[model samples]
Target chain A: MIEVAGLKKSFGDVVALRTVSFKAEDARVTGLLGHNGAGKSTSLRILYGLIQPDTGFAKIDGVNVSQDRILAQSKLGVLPDGQGLYQRLTPREHMRYFGRLHGMTEDMIEQRSQELIGMLDMGSIADRRTGGFSQGERMKVCLARALVHNPKHIVLDEPTNGLDVMTTRKVREMIQELKTLGLCVLFSSHLMYEVSKLCDEIIIMAEGRVAAQGTPEQILATAEESSLEDAFVTLSERVAQI
Target chain B: MNILRTIVAKELLDGVRDRRSLFSAFLFPFLAPLFIYGLMTLVIQQNTETESITLPVINADAAPALVAHLKEAGFIIEAFEGDPEAEVAAKTVELVLSIPIDYQKTMAAFETTRVTIIHDGSRNDTSATVRQVRNLVRIYSSELNALRLVSRGVSPKLMRGLQTENGDIASDEQRAANFLSFVPIYVLMAAFVCGLGLAIDQTAGERERRSLEPLLINPVSRLSIVFGKCLAASIVAALGMLITLGMCLGAMLMLPIDELGIRFSLKAQQVVGLIMAILPIPLLASSLQLLLGLFAKSFKDAQSYVGFLVFIPVVPTLVMNFLPFATSFWMYFVPVFGQSIMMKEILGAEPVPLLAYPAAALPTLLAGLLVCWLTSRLLDQERVIQS
Candidate 1:
């Protein structure tokens, strides 16, 4: 499980995260819904200890992220906003590299990489260099790279931002598969259909603050709206008024 | 240790596969020595070629004997039908030799005679010709004086009691040192230039490609990452300098340095010694480049800073070359400066002091370690990450 409470971060005079709080439980998919600059990325970066928050704390599997970063990070899989892939390296190399950084042995790395390659349906391009790969193929490599150590918690930032429809469906399926395996999966997105279809709970954010958090049906009922889209707009405009 | 190994292996493989980095790491080192060799050959060729001197003779009929003597001494005498001074001023003639009309009468009467040699003093090659003509005339006058002394039954030794001869101490090897003085500068510059591409690519290039964030997100200490990258850069730099050293040695062997009357050759042992002497320099170069590259905002910015940073190692060499200072034992403490002086001493066949070796190498190794530590610290800063 991933838990964040009172997370606040500011850059100079601008606050990127303001009193943000949320919880993603095990065996469920929780979607962080926000528009651009709504602090979804910032919140995730803080959770992984890439950036420190001015106030509040984050924990992964009961380990405090800021105090014990290495231990907390070891128990979590993170796909940062940037798809940082070495173009000259193949999927297997990327997996081995990340696995080693996570302190896994060689045999463990190889076996985990093979399992990931098979699970992600990446056998066709597993050994191919990633220089000119399609968006879907690149996403698979990144996903496999993140899951190489099989962490209990997985965090993704806009995983299907620019993917095609088929590729987006593949990513949704992967998220469903992770959920079925009883892993806590937290991801950020602005796509309503994906959020409604995949997330058991939703955290809707507006202007660096969490405006509402609950199941899709609960968010709609609280906002007195018919669809998740209306509920998001209503909550966002209500926070903007405040 | 595992993290470091993985990073180093990846950096080495990535650097080798990058064609642009490969060119900087492997190809540019050879170009420097080959370029210097070509320039050296051209200079030596132009200096050694022999050419006959030309002098326009005025009133040739009045001094046939002197004219014959000048011709025999390898002066191509041109008969002047016009004013010789005007011909020289017009740049048509390099030199003019004028003999007075009473030249024979003056010789018979044993009177002092005046001869004129007019030549352009501004031309570099004209000085040799002027000196040659002056010497020939002086020799002729001395012979006449000796003959007159013989005719008078008075020994010429009475007029010239003391004789002085010069014995110069310069050997061919010592003279060759002058031509090969810039070897250390080129080799040191090669050390810096070889690692430039890899250092910039691994540091600023990683940031520009958005890979550093992901890499840093892994559960590894920042020191391991920086050290791994620096070690890979140092290895690439060291290998490049080794190749450059070999190529420089080959260039030295191929050039006919003997034509310059210099018995110059670099033996295998000396080459090995030189390599050992410069062992710490590549590490220093790579670490410095890594620090500067990481500080800069982008790859282009890092490359620009590195371009300026190269002058740091070269400044000492330039100062030493242009304004030669007396080298002392204390010079071995300065990084590039020490290496430059040591290499010159080694190549010039001068004995290297036993203590000078470590003095030249230790400081740079320590500086490399310090800079690498500083880079790792910088990696944790929020500004560097955001930038």
Candidate 2:
């Protein structure tokens, strides 16, 4: 489980996050829906212990990230926004390296890597260098590397952005599989339909604050709109008026 | 420690597979020794080849005996009718020997015969030739005087009052050291440049690729990452320095410097001593490079910064090698300068002063650690990652 409370962050004179709070329970997929510059990336970054928040606290499985980042990070697998792959390294090497960083033994790394490769259907390109991989292949490698050590919680920023329809379906399938396995998965995206399709709970952010948080039907009920898209637009317009 | 080791292993694997980094680290260091050896060979060849000495003798008939003696001494006597001064000024002839019309009259009167040897003073190649001709004339004049004294039934020994003998106190090794003065400068430069590619690749290159953020999100400490990357770069730097030192030693031993009457040989002990003295330098170089890379916003910026940093070590080498000031113990406290001075001592086979090695090493080690600490702090800063 992952918990964030009263997250507040600012850079210079611009405030990025203000009074943002949410909870992502295990065995569920929580999607953070926000437009550009809505502080989705910043909140996720703070939760992953990559950056510190001015006034907030994030906990991964009851361990506070700010107080003990190493211990907190050990329980979380983060795929940062626009993460780069080492061109000279293969998918297998990438998995092994992250596994070692997570303190996995050689045998465990090998066994877990083989399992992930099979599950992700990446056995064909497992040994090939990632220099010229397709976008879908690269995404699979990134997701597999993040999941190599089998952390209890997974955080991904813009996981399906800029992917083809086929690759997006593959990623959605993988997220569903994680949900079935009882892993708390938190992902951020701007796609309304993708969020409506995959997210068990949706948190809509506007102007660095949580505009609404609920299931799809609850969000529609709160906005008094018939479609999820109309509900998001109506909610965003309300935040804009403020 | 375990995390540091794992990071280092990954870095080494990445570096070894990078052709650009491997090329700069392994292949560039050999150029220094090859360049120095090539120049040395050219100089030796130029010094060994003999050229015949030629001179234009003006008014040749005035002093037949002197001219005959000059001819007997293997001088290629040429006859020139023009003014000797103009001929030398025009560079038509390298030298001119002008004997006055009354040369034999002065010689027969038992007086000193004045002979003028004219050559351009600005020409270095002519200096040796002028000295040769001057010595020949002096010897002939002295012989004639001795004959006259013996013919008059007087001993020639009575005319001599003071005898001067010349002695050279410079040892052969000292001369050889002078010949090989550029070695220390090249070795230090090698230490700085060999690890440059790896350092920038591991730090700035990783940032440019966008891999640093995800890697940092793992549970590893910032210090471990810094230490591992610095260690990997230093290994490459130190190995390049050692290879350069070896190539220099090999060139010195393989060349015919011994045939030039100079004692030039590198002992096994000297090689070991040099390695010991130079081992700490790569750590210092690698840290400086890493620090610069961390501060730089892009890989190209880091590369240009590192390119300019290489001259830092060379500046002290130039001052120490060329200046005439006495080397005090405090010189060993300076970073690159100290290493350079110590290398000179090791090459000359001099007995190094006590505490000099540690004094040279401790400052660099401390500076390296300080920069490494600063790098770790930078890793924690938001500016480095955001940039």
Candidate 3:
């Protein structure tokens, strides 16, 4: 499980996050929803220990991220905001690299690689270099490597931001599968439809603050809107008024 | 330790597969030797050219005796009737020797007559040949005076003066060592050039590709990651330095250095000494490259920064070449300068101080570590990751 409380961060004069809080429980999919420049990536970055929050705490399985990043990172599987891969490395090599970084033995890395390749249906391209991989193929490689260590908490930032329909569906299915495996899966996205479809809990952010947090039904009831998209618009407008 | 090894292995594999990185690593080792060979061959050719001069002579009939004397002196004489001035001015020949029309009459009367050597004063290539011809003429003039004095019953010894003897202390090996001084510089250059691409690619290229954030997310210490990359680059650079040294030795062996009146050969111990002197440079070079690469905003920016960094090795060489300073004990503490001076001394068969190796290498290795440490500190910054 991942828990963040009272997270505040700023870059120079611009505040990236302000008094934001959320909890992503195991066996559930939680989505941080926001528009562009709405601080979704910044909040996730702090949670992943990439940046320090000014005044807040992010815990991965009860280990404070800021106090002990290595321990916190060991429990976290992250497909970060920038999911770049080595062009010359094959998918299996990528898996081995990350798996080794996570302190796995060669045998364990091999076993995990095989399982991920099979699960992602990436067997055909497992040995090929990723230099000219299509967007879907690249995403799969990134996702496979992220899951190589099989951490209890998985965080993906905009996992399907620019993917085609088929690749996007593949990513959505992977998130659901992780949720069913009793893992705490947290993702951030600007797509309302994807959030409403995949998330069991939603945290709506506006202007670096959490505007609302609840289940889809509770969010709709609170915002007095029929669709989650209209509810997000209403909640953001309410924050703007404040 | 295992994490460091994994990072190193991954970086090495990535570097090996990059055509650009491999090209950068191996290109200088091959080209530097070929360049040294070409340069040494040109030097030897120029030296030999001066030994056998072809002199174009005008009015040869008026000075047959002098022509005979020159031919005996090993000057290849070619009789000519054209304008001596024009021939030399056009560089059709190196120089022209014009015997004046009154040469025989003046010689019979024992009067001094000028034999004009028409040549371009600004041309340095023919200067040695001109001096040889003038000396031969002076010898012939003095010989004629000696014979005249003997015939007149005047002792030729009366004209003798104090004789000056030349004392040249430089040995043939010492002279040859001067020609081989560039060998050390080339080997040092290999250290800087070979690992440059990989160093930049691993640091700044990672950032530009946006792979750094993902890589950093893995459960590894920043020091381990930076050290691993630095070690990987240093390994390539060290290999390059060794190949360049071997190639330089081979090229030196193939050159006809003995024909240039110099004895040039490398002792087994001296080659080992040269290797030891330059071995630390790769570590220094890659660490500096990695440090500068971290500050760059992109891969191309890092390349520009690294391009300027290559001049570090060359600055000391150029200073030693142009504004040479006396070798001091403290020079052994400087990195490239120390390696350069040591390599030259080894090639020249001079005994290096026992402490010089550690004195030179330890500081370089330490500085590399310091740079790697600073890079690790930089890695912790959010700006570096996001930039």
Candidate 4:
């Protein structure tokens, strides 16, 4: 379980997040919905211990990671929004590197990397440097890396970003499979269809605060809309206007 | 065998894949040194050929026989009037060589006559003219000594001071070793320049290419990435230094030393001594350069920043060879300081005590490690990754 409480942060005078609070329960995919500048990525980043919040606490399995990050980040996996993997390293090499950092033995890394390679269908490119990989391939390689150490909690920011329609559908199906495996999934995205297709629960963020949270169908029914996009629009009027 | 191994392998693979970098890191090592040192040697050879200049002699006494003797010695001597100062400043004259008017009186009394040399130090031909004047003075002194010895009825051969002609009896090995004095300086310079290029291309080039973000997102600690790149740069630097050494020795031997007129001879063993003397300087220079390059946010920044390392060796090198310095144990540990001293020792200028080797090598290697470790820690900070 991951909990973010009162996540107030600022960059100079611009408030990036304000009193943000949410929880990602086990065995469910929680979709963080937001447009540009909606603080979705910021929230994910803060939870991943990449940046310290001015006044907030991000906990992973009841351990406050912002205070003692090394413990918190160890149990979590994050695929950052824009940042790609080191281009020089091959996928196999990347997996091994992360495995070692996460305290896995050389044999364990080799085994885990093999499993991930098979599951991800990236065996062919595993030995090749990631420098020349296509965007979708790179994204998948990042995904394989996230699972390399077999962390309990996964936090992905815009996992399907810059991906083609076919790749997006595959990624959505993968997320569903992850949920079935009882993994706690915390993913952020602006695409309504993608979020509605994969996430079990939706947490729509507007500006710096949580505007709504519930099952996609329930939220849509309450908002008197037939689609998740209309429901998001109904709840995020102020942010949409701004 | 480990994740660090994977990272290092990946770094090496990437280094090889980047063609521009491959050219700079590997090829430039051989080409750049040959070009630079070769060009330098050529320039020196051109400038050092014997020079000819006109000598102006001012004889206030108007001594005809002395002027005739000077003319016979191939000096383009010209007569000047007034006190030597007036003719010293005259145009079309390089120098004022004044023989005192009382030269005959002083010579009869067995007294030495003063010959004052005067010229504007800032003049274009001042150095050349001064050297010619000194040569003329020597010839004149030799003639006078010969004349004085004959008048005293002493054997002219006695003035040769027992003819005790001393030539350096050092073996070919020692002479070749002595020539190695420049090896440390050259290797350090080449290595620093090579590392500068490698570091900039690895660090700032990655950032510019927008490949840095993906690398930072990895679960691996940032230290792994920094060290990976640092090690790669060090390897490239090592390659360049080795190539320079190899090529220089090859050029020294294969390129016809007799043809080049460089009496300097360096064999394989002498090359090994140069390698030993220079081994530590590269670690010191390259590590510092990498640390500096990491701070650069752009390739140009890294390029200019690393450029400073290349020139740094100049001071230590020129100082060791051209300036007055005494070798001590402490000096060996002072980065280029130790290497330069050891190099001088290789050159048969063994003022450097052999006991100072440990004091010099250990501290320098340790200091380099300390700096490299600090750079690793600084890079591990997440803020640097995002930046």
Full-model lDDT for every candidate:
0.86, 0.88, 0.90, 0.72
lDDT of 3 by residue, B1-115 (tens): 9998999999999999998669857989999899889988987776676434778888888998889999888888888788778878899888888888889999889898888
Best-matching candidate per lDDT: 3
lDDT by residue for model 2 (B1-387), tens: 778888889888888889876985777678879888998886775455334567789898888888888888777788768888888999998889999888878877887778899889998667767887898898887788788989999898877778888676757776787678777777888888899998998889998988989889999888888988999999889989888888988888777877677887678888888888888999989999999998999999999998898888778767866685667999999998888878877777777886988999999899998999999899877779765
lDDT per residue (tens digit) for residues B1-387 in model 1: 777888899899888888876875677678888898999897676565434666788888888878888888877788776777777778888788888889889888999989998877887656667787899899888888898999999898886888888675756665676677767777787788888899998888888877888888888877788889988998988888888777877887788889877878777777777997898998889988999888998789899998886676678767877898888888899988898888877787777887888998999899888999999888877667754
Candidate 1 docking band? medium
Span of 10 residues, lowest total lDDT, candidate 3 chain A: A76-85
Candidate number with the higher TM-score (1 or 2): 2
Candidate 3, CAPRI quality class derived from DockQ: medium
After superposing candidate 2, which stretches have Cα over 4 Å from the reference?
B47-50, B53-170, B259-261
Off by over 4 Å in 1: B51-175
Q: Rank order by DockQ, top first?
A: 3, 2, 1, 4
**iRMS of each prediction in angstroms?**
1.1, 0.8, 0.9, 3.9
- All candidates in order of lDDT, best leading: 3, 2, 1, 4
lDDT at residue B168 of model 3 (Cα atoms): 64
Fnat of candidates, each listed: 0.69, 0.80, 0.81, 0.31
Candidate with maximal DockQ: 3
Which scores higher on TM-score, 1 or 3?
3
lDDT of 4 by residue, B14-63 (tens): 66766776676566557755775676466444435343334566674455
Model 2, docking class: medium
